[model samples]
Target: MVRGNIRGSAARGGIAACCGLAFLLFGYDQGVLGAVIGLDSFRKEFDDPNRNLEGIIAAIYDIGCFVGAIVAFLTADYFGRKGSITLGTWIMVVGTILQTASFEKIQMIISRIITGIGNGMNTAMLVIQSALIAFGHPLSTFMGLASRQAEPSSFGWRWPIAFQGVFIAAILMFLPFLPESPRWLVHKGRIEEATDVFARLAGKNSTINDPDVVRERDDIVASVEEEKKLGEATWSEVFTEGKNRNISRVLLGAGPYMMNQWSGINCLAYFLPITFERNIHLSVELSLILAGVLGIQYFALSWL
Candidate 1:
């Protein structure tokens, strides 16, 4: 059977576009709640949840994302990159529906977690998770503004949550025509299929035996064989120095992300509008506008 039709840079571009949409959905979900959380209608619907409850409602998605990451870790190889993303997209759709229809705080929280899980799975399988995040935030902010301008009812909040479906739909549409990760095929001992993927990714002029395809295919096979010889590293080995400074390497790799998270940027990202209103003493309207501007700033700077 045939795989993806596109080849070379075109195929890579298609795959990158799919990954970009996935992260865009992630950023939209991250910022959409903040856009509407401070609204009178939102507060009224949830009975004016206290700061504690509000925090839970806002932060619970991360917990779901963590679980989703673990889920991806356990299942991504078996499902393959494309499969993991497709599954995650469907899960996000389900979660988005639950969130949009939510009238109760509990349902909203649960839905947020579900959405996070899907995002987590996608992030685990793809790169550049944050590259397009700024775009998503501003898009959500615009949606929130438009929905509120149209009607200051529940639709204001619900529409922002549901707008995520558009991005999810793009992913579904593009995924089928995209090739799975060639390295993953090699890992599964599907050499011929992996070669085909390499050929498609290399260019239309390339075949399975094309020199470029052969070199890459052989490189992946060698790398996979070396990994097989080392065997899978256990959780404990991650902390131990059984072979090489695994612990140090892990810390070096993870430290930047940990510090970024710890720097409270997310707190700002997730609650920017609210912070502007409550802390900076700005009006809600001004706060939302400023948040949107900040989101634009983030999006622009991301290119650098």
Candidate 2:
């Protein structure tokens, strides 16, 4: 039994790691614009001199995020968490390609919107995935480790976006091995499949091959059945009845967290090269190397 528990924990940890990859993509997308916009080519391409256009381009991405969040909330219940995440991955791929190919500021703005949508959807999916994993297994430790290692280097923004594409592909490949949330399955009235998933996750070869697995499955079924008999509202109905009020409150309260991005620290760090070259009278290459060192310091602080 102890061995089985260990195996089960490991499997869940693997799934959480997969979900964390998605989150890392989200973070990379969030930070890539800052890093790349500081490059001479990017500024010259956009014909931006005083850095005014940078804020507009960045804000467009945030606008896209607003749209994506609304869409994710509406579709998560209908499509299921895994399905939504898969869709988000496709969006990320297309957005990355568009951004990479963009030659004009307007085109890049559109691409940022596309990428922002993907990021927002993936963020919602990450929360759902975390909750699902936490339901059946202890995932705090895995999540902590994953969060610490999410960011990569600051060479160029393209590297991070390209890395996102690679990780998204890896996630899609690994999704087939993961069990869908049994709670979601049960809610959808897929009792037998839910039981099988639970058994598999618990390391049983088959649902019928293990007595403890059978008992656990029965418990879940019975609990879901009881809830069904109580005529609990559908997601939409619950939302209408203020069931989501607390969630809304929490989200609203956390809005200030996004302000951290605009706190000037990241902007200064990103443009450290330009700042040094223009303000302190340094060479571009030397300024870039200094900027990199400062970026490393910020990245290290993220882990702390």
Candidate 3:
């Protein structure tokens, strides 16, 4: 039976709050790198590797992320969205800790990979990020500045990286209380649970057969039925299924994102301060300030 409170505002609020926070941490991790890569103390410690090396250092995260995305799809059938997200959070916490504690290049790279894996898993379940996740950019920038100012030491980069776990902890705290995705439950043939979750999320305090709840639940169940009619879902079917040309649709959908990732946009986000300071010959202080501004812009526009 659905928990009496499951359909209350509290449950929906909990879902949004936890998911938003996790996404926020993911964004902040992405943004903080730009600042971390350029810090004077960090550069001095690591001898300011060349652009290619720096690129490799940053890009390896994507490698792990790619692997994680595949793993997410493969495992999601069994684990469900909530399970995947929970496991991802644990991996991210471990990754964030290792990243914070790193003292060497390879260690940082490995940690980045671990962190990316967690992100990839989380994203697979829920890719919607806007206002909340956007905070990651500005906060990362702010943390960078704070770290710099606190300094006679290297705490600037480390602290921002480390604090990522704070958000992760919040997510984990709420996970147990949250309902699994209704769609996932439906797909797994847990119709009653799906109906309950749908009603709860919609803030409707209604019975299993209540008109509104039944309509929504039936709509979702119909989709699952359609999939069942199409033969067991498999990689082979993805390329051959549906009048919409499923493979083409998938390509159409993912093409832009694929292009964007390959574009140098993220490279700039991760290493903007370094790029400005090194290539443009801007003063380090000035470059960092500009990077912070860029973060602010990203944050504001993310809501759009």
Model 1: CA > 4 A from native: 1-4
Better of 1 and 2 by lDDT: 1
Each candidate's number of clashing pairs is 0, 0, 3
**Over 4 Å off in model 2, which ranges?**
1-10, 128-163, 204-304
lDDT computed for candidate 1: 0.88
- Model 2 agreement with the true structure over 109-144: per-residue lDDT tens digits: 899899889877877766533232111111211221
> Which window of 10 residues has the lowest lDDT sum in candidate 3?
1-10
Candidate order by decreasing lDDT = 1, 3, 2
Query: Which order, best to worst by TM-score?
Result: 1, 3, 2
Off by over 4 Å in 3: 1-6, 131-133, 237-244
Candidate with maximal TM-score: 1
Candidate 1 lDDT for residue 69: 93
Which of the two, 1 or 2, has more TM-score? 1
Residue-level error in angstroms, candidate 3, position 81? 0.7
**lDDT per residue, candidate 1, 65-98, as tens digits?**
9999999989988999889988998999899999
Candidate 1 residue pairs in backbone clash: none
Over 1-304, each residue of candidate 3 has an lDDT whose tens digit, in order, gives 2334656688878888877887787778887877777776676656776777788878888787787888898899799889998898899988898888888888888999999999888876775555665678668877787788755477867887887888898888888889988888999999988987877776655677778889999999999889889867678767884786998888888999889878878867677777888899997678878887877787788776
